[model samples]
Target chain A: DAGVTQSPTHLIKTRGQHVTLRCSPISGHKSVSWYQQVLGQGPQFIFQYYEKEERGRGNFPDRFSARQFPNYSSELNVNALLLGDSALYLCASSSATKLFFGSGTQLSVL
Target chain B: QKEVEQDPGPLSVPEGAIVSLNCTYSNSAFQYFMWYRQYSRKGPELLMYTYSSGNKEDGRFTAQVDKSSKYISLFIRDSQPSDSATYLCAMMSAGGTSYGKLTFGQGTILTVHP
Candidate 1:
C-alpha cells in the first residue's frame, strides 16, 4: 500500500507571500499531523487534525494554520511568510500505535 | 530544559560493530517511547516503540527504557553502511489531554563505514 504522500516536494516563496502545502494520509487513517523541521533541528509540531476537527496545536504563530478535508487529506497554510519560516514541513498519519510520515515539503522563504 | 535530550553525534563506526544511541527525558508523564530514522531531505520513519519501561528486541535492533532514570537507548548490532542516518527519540503522554503529541529529541547522526 502507498504510504503518506505530500505534494509540491519543494517550494520557494518570498517574504510576505502565502504558501500552502498538501498531504494525503494512508488508507483508512484518520489522524493527520503537521510538523516543521529546521536545518539541524528536530521536527517541531504544528497542527494535528482527527476526523476533520482540530485536535491539537503547537506554539507556532497565528500565521500558520491547517485543515483536514473529508477525505483525510490535509493542507498547511502559512500567511505573510517570513524568512524564519523556511524549513521542511512534514505530515504524518497515525495507525493504532505508530505514525507514518511523508517525504515532506521543503519550503524556502527568500 | 528540553523535554528530550539526545547527543547530536556524527558517530562513525565500522560495519559489523555494535552501535548504541541514547536519549534522556525530563518529562515523567511520558509513557510511550519511540525511535525514528530519517534520511537527508526525507521524513522520519518509525523504528522501535515501547510503552512503560523495559527492553524490547527485534532482529538486530534493541530498545531499552529506564523510567526511573528517564533514560532510553537503542542498540543496533552488526551495523551496516545502509544504517547511516539520523536517529531521533520521541515520547508522549498516554491517556491524557496531550496524548498523541510527540515530543522529540534533537536527533543523533550515525554513519557506518563499509
Candidate 2:
C-alpha cells in the first residue's frame, strides 16, 4: 500500500503571507499529525487529529492550525508567516502503535 | 532546557564499526521511546520503537530504553555507508492531554564511510 502522501513538495512564500500544506494519510489510517522541522533540527510537533477531532496540540503559535477530514486527510495552515516559519512540514499517519511519515513539504519564507 | 536532549554528533565511523547513539529525556511520564532516521531534505522514517524499559533488536539495529535513568540508546552493528543519516530520538507520553504527541531531540548526524 502507498504510504502517507503530501502535496506541493516545495513552496516559497513571503513574510505576512499565508500558506496551506496538505497531507493524505495511508488507507485505513484514521490518525494524522503535523510537524515542523528546521534545518539541522528534529521535527517539532504542531497538531494531531484523530477522527477529525483535535487530539493534541504543541507549543506552536495561533498562526498555525490544522484539521482532519472525514476521509482522514489533513491540512496545515500558517498565517502571517515569518522568516522563522521556513522549514519542512511533515505529515504522519498512524495506526494504534506505528506511525509513518511523508516526504514533507519544504516551505521557504522570505 | 529541551525535554529531550541528544548529542547531535556529526559522527564519522568506518564501515563494519559498531555505532551507538543516545538521548536523555527529562519527562518522567514519557512511556514510548522511538528512534527515527532522516536523510537530507526528507522526512524522518521510524527505525525502532520501544515501550518502558528493555532492549529490542531488529537485524543490525538495537534499541535500548532505561526508564529509571530517563535515557535511551540505539546501536547499529556492522554499519554501512548507507547507514549515514541523521538519527533522531523521540518520546511520547502514555496518556493524558499529551496523548499521541511525540517529543523529539536534536538529531545526531552519522556518516558511515566505506
| Model 1 regions lying over 4 Å from their true place | none
TM-score of each: 0.98, 0.98
Residue-level lDDT tens digits of model 1 in A1-110:
99999999999999999999999999999989899999898988899888888988999999999999999999999999999999999999985547778999999999
Over the stretch B1-114, how does candidate 2's per-residue lDDT look in tens digits? 999999998899999999999999999989899999999998899999998999999999999999999999999999999999999999998764465589999999999999
Interface RMSD in Å per candidate, to 1 decimal? 1.4, 1.3
Candidate 1 accuracy as TM-score:
0.98
Off by over 4 Å in 2: none
In terms of lDDT, the best-performing candidate is 2
What is the DockQ of the complex in model 2? Answer: 0.74
Give a tens-digit lDDT track for model 2, residues A1-110: 99999999999999999999999999999999899999988899999999999999888999999988989999999999999999999999987656789999999999
